[model samples]
Target: MSQQSVIQIALIEDDEIVRLAISQRLQLAGYDVIECADGESALSLIPTGFPGIVISDVRLPDISGLALLPQLLANNPEMPVILMTGHGDINMAVNALRDGAFDFLEKPFDPDKLIETVGCAIEKRQLQLGANKREEYLQQAQGLDQILIGSSPGMVELRQQLVKIANIDTNVIIYGDTGCGKELVADCLHKVSTRSQGNFVALNCAAIPEALFESELFGHEAGAFTGAIKKRIGKLEYADKGTLFLDEIESMPLNMQIKMLRILQEKLIVRVGGNKSIAIDVRVIAAAKESLKDNQGFRQDLFYRLNVAQLYLPPLRERGEDILLLFEHYVNLANIHAKPLSGLDEKTLLAYGWPGNVRELINVATRFGLDASLTVADILVTKPLASIDSSASELSLAMQTQNFERKVIAEALRTHKGSIIEVMDILDLPRRTLNQKMQKYDLHRADYI
Candidate 1:
């Protein structure tokens, strides 16, 4: 509602007597009317700020009101449109709605009903405008959910570096194994930094072919190469005033690396076959799996340039407790997709080392969940229970406990047909106690029968 208590409404009608009657009724209902005799004139007034609502007859001279609806919305989608059609013009009203006309009032409409429809349309328009503004704010904020995962000493130190370096505009080199979430760390820095609102572009140096690497990094003028039919924009230009992520930098061609070094020095790029140099303001985030010190082929000068700052990601095996945290995260994700939840059985968790890191844990958890019948016991049994070496009596105790745990759970599972509640009752234990024991012995009731 505005300071003007009466809402301003535009009416398009060729019939004079009906228009007067409708205008009189609307005026009495606290509305200010701007009347038009044809659709073309009404459409022209749409951009001139005639009124908040448009009430138009379907059939009009010059242009049909139904046909003008789309053009009206293209100019200002917030304006509500109510179409007026005669009894036999139901099809036109339906077409108006499909084309995004807010609402329709069939000719000979009740005055009160028409007023209600306009009010509803106004409310919906306000809601949409608010929602759009909120979304814009969220996009600008770049939200904080992109932080990398880990709790190892290496990871903790890396996070400390991120917090310290986010304010500085410097090149960064990230080192990590494949699937070790190096890119995730890059994203976190970009989002948390002062350049959060700018574009964050990524290119895999290894994935791009050698033949097209030059053209891809730098734009080209029309007729630059044999197949270069048109002028094109490049990633370097697109990432201006933003951040560019160069992944697998170790695999970048030596020739391209040299060109990149020059670009880093000059802060400008010359397109292929184009002499004009375009100045760019961008930050670079380069990543590689190999150590900069060990890789002799990597240009030491280039490494030094990118290494203005560096962050190393620890593999999953090194983050002892963080492995279980990641495991629970995956389980929750699986549940959202209607998959079963699973956790590591004690024996299997303690036995098999996670060589594939956090990525391996997610993969194994996904496999376990998709096969919903798999339980703790099944996971334990599949893993080898080797190396019971100890003092003779201690080794005997270990074997005896493992066998006893297995036998009790196996008999209980058989008798109960794998009903979790029934098994708990037979064992006279709480659900967590049963689950703990099952995990301890690597026992899965689902796999037993």
Candidate 2:
């Protein structure tokens, strides 16, 4: 609460004597105050983004503080509201606390208690606001490493490639197997590029119907066709001065493919029923599962135009080094309260062939996180259309324990990227003991790194 810093208090009391007395106490304690006569004025009195605590009397002339409490919170739910109540209103005050009042002061207010409660409210509000700001900044400022969530050589090289061509205006083509995060890569390209401030519009060529694809790409004018009641914006125009990501570009109809090429080459679009030419300055990022280089279904000229910046996303299997890291990340995201993935779970994750790639990995991790009773091995065995070697689950107790020990050591090694010293410290094992365990487990540090 400055001469104009964040406000500290919003006092709404009809009794002038009590209000003045409370205001004097708060001011003496080095706090700010905003006084209101009744709830009506306060409904719009307190400015938006006040960042202050509200202190209101339960009984007001126009509207009770109870009604205004929700209205006050509607703007900023985090705002701490302290209510004042009379002797007989103790029960009502308690109910108000449950209804989201920060705290309540009984009439015949204690000056010391008032100061103390205000101090505590300020501290709590500051902590919450600080945490919100930190998280908001982290989301905007996170780099590719945090967003992509991997450290394998392939991932490292992939990040480098994105950095290399992020600023380039040429159209890009990303090649990857299904669920390999082509769109994620495209998003990364858009986020890090100079055009980051503009929009990043994505369209899955496979998802849209052939008949609607054109209108979806190039928006229509008002009353252009049946059900076209108003003017609409297309993906290309919406993505102006930004990036346009076309996922599964191979699925785009042949006729639409030609228009996509023209949008890329001419940087212009004409609405479905409008004769005006609309210019679009957008970078196209097309993704495909297979090579479009010599495909009969695609136009060679358009393919060449889109293939300017080729980004190949390695399948999850190809980046074996990142399997545990990726799985652990998704698991953490799904289950905030979930314990760490067990040694057996990690072992199962490695042994299975993720037919659906990263997308499948997320579903498996989500299920593993949500169902506390089920392990990765359990989920894998029951999952449809996928096969896994669950032989590790059938081992004798003694053998299973040994296998778990090996799995834990190997998982630690992988997590540390084959750094023996780091793994040793993390596991609290002496060098000789760690080396002996590694030998018994047939685990190679080179393989992990």
Candidate that scores best on lDDT: 2
The window of 10 residues in a row where model 2 has the poorest summed lDDT is 386-395
Candidate 1: residue pairs that collide: 346-439, 376-443, 377-443, 377-444, 378-444, 380-442
Q: Which regions of candidate 1 are displaced past 4 Å?
A: 1-146, 336-351, 375-449
Superposed by TM-score, candidate 1 places the C-alpha of residue 68 at a distance from the truth, in angstroms, of: 79
Those runs of model 2 whose alpha carbons end farther than 4 Å from true positions after fitting are 1-142, 386-449
Prediction 1 TM-score vs. true: 0.54
Give lDDT: candidate 2, residue 135: 41
lDDT per residue (tens digit) for residues 1-449 in model 1: 54124346788888899888888887776777889898777767666433367888877777888777877777777677888878536576667767877677776777777766666555444434433443343335323322454445776788888878887999999988776888888988898899888889999999999999999989898999998999998889888988999999998999998999999999999989899999998899999988876577788888888899888888765665555445545655666453322222323433345555566567666655566555433543343445211221022335445655666786788788888789988889897467546644445666645
Q: Please give the RMSD to the true structure for each candidate, in Å.
A: 23.6, 20.9
Q: Tell me the tens digit of each residue's lDDT in model 2 across 290-402.
A: 99989999999999998888988888877863777777667768887775554455556666667678988899888878886566766765655324324422324554566
